[model samples]
Target: MATPRQDSSPKGFRPAFYRMKDVIRITSLSRPTLYRRIAAGRFPAPVKLGGRASGWSAQALQAWIDNPSGYAAEPTADDPAS
Candidate 1:
């Protein structure tokens, strides 16, 4: 019989997924504003989790929080390097 695979993650290293409420709480932005910014590409987009659920990447959110001025400075795969 084949054994099941184990995650075996180290303590305190698990990634955290923040819901809309959590994002609003941490960023202090209203729901309408948050969604508006997302629509305008001013904020990081959330990943679709299911038909009715979505969440932003915590790492990406953290980066924005860390540096709001140059948050979009880093070129993305679609953006050409300059």
Candidate 2:
């Protein structure tokens, strides 16, 4: 993967969206792992931005990184926490 480009915009002018490659770079996750998490509903879903294009929310991704336990495996009602 190519190195992500540094934001060149002024402090207030940066674009709100990031490409899939950017997302992959930021999360340090392989394509399959990222998609698998999405399929399992453990990660944020990408929004369709344009023709054959999609992107995830930067805020949401950051939040997930900040609190990873929310994505950990959980027991069903029949199972006791241990």
Candidate 3:
């Protein structure tokens, strides 16, 4: 008899991080617009993944998706309060 495979992640779980391309695709915002929004504190900043690599948190992106116009970036230790 074959054993059943077990799934570790929760149901409907997605990747915890999204690359810039993924973010742009999900938000339907151009690269420039995304950067501008991030600079203006209207979008979530991506977390550093490693050398020269960064990705946005799925939770953060989902929050923005739920309320785009009202979305505000939360300050992180790497970012200075403005």
Best by TM-score: 3
Off by over 4 Å in 3: 1-11
lDDT of 3: 0.91
TM-score, prediction 1: 0.64
Ranking by TM-score: 3, 2, 1
CA lDDT for candidate 2: 0.72
C-alpha RMSD values across all candidates: 8.5, 8.3, 4.9
In candidate 2, which residue pairs get closer than 3 Å at backbone N, Cα or C atoms, i.e. clash? Answer: none
Comparing 2 with 3 on lDDT, the higher-scoring candidate is 3
Q: Candidate 1: lDDT of 7?
A: 69
Query: Sorted by lDDT, highest first, which candidate order results?
Result: 3, 1, 2
Q: Across residues 46-80, which tens digit of lDDT does each residue of candidate 3 receive?
A: 88999999999999999999999999888767665
The deviation in Å at residue 45 for candidate 1 is 0.6
Q: What is the lDDT of residue 15 in candidate 3?
A: 98
lDDT of 2 by residue, 1-82 (tens): 9999997768865346667798788888888988888766576667789899888767667666787558643333544554
List candidate 1 stretches off by more than 4 Å: 1-15, 73-82
RMSD of 3: 4.9
Candidate 2 clashes: the total is 0
For residues 1-82, write the lDDT of model 1, one tens digit per residue. Answer: 9999986998777356688988998899999988887765577877788899888878878987997656663445764554
Give the C-alpha miss distance for residue 47 in model 2, angstroms: 0.3
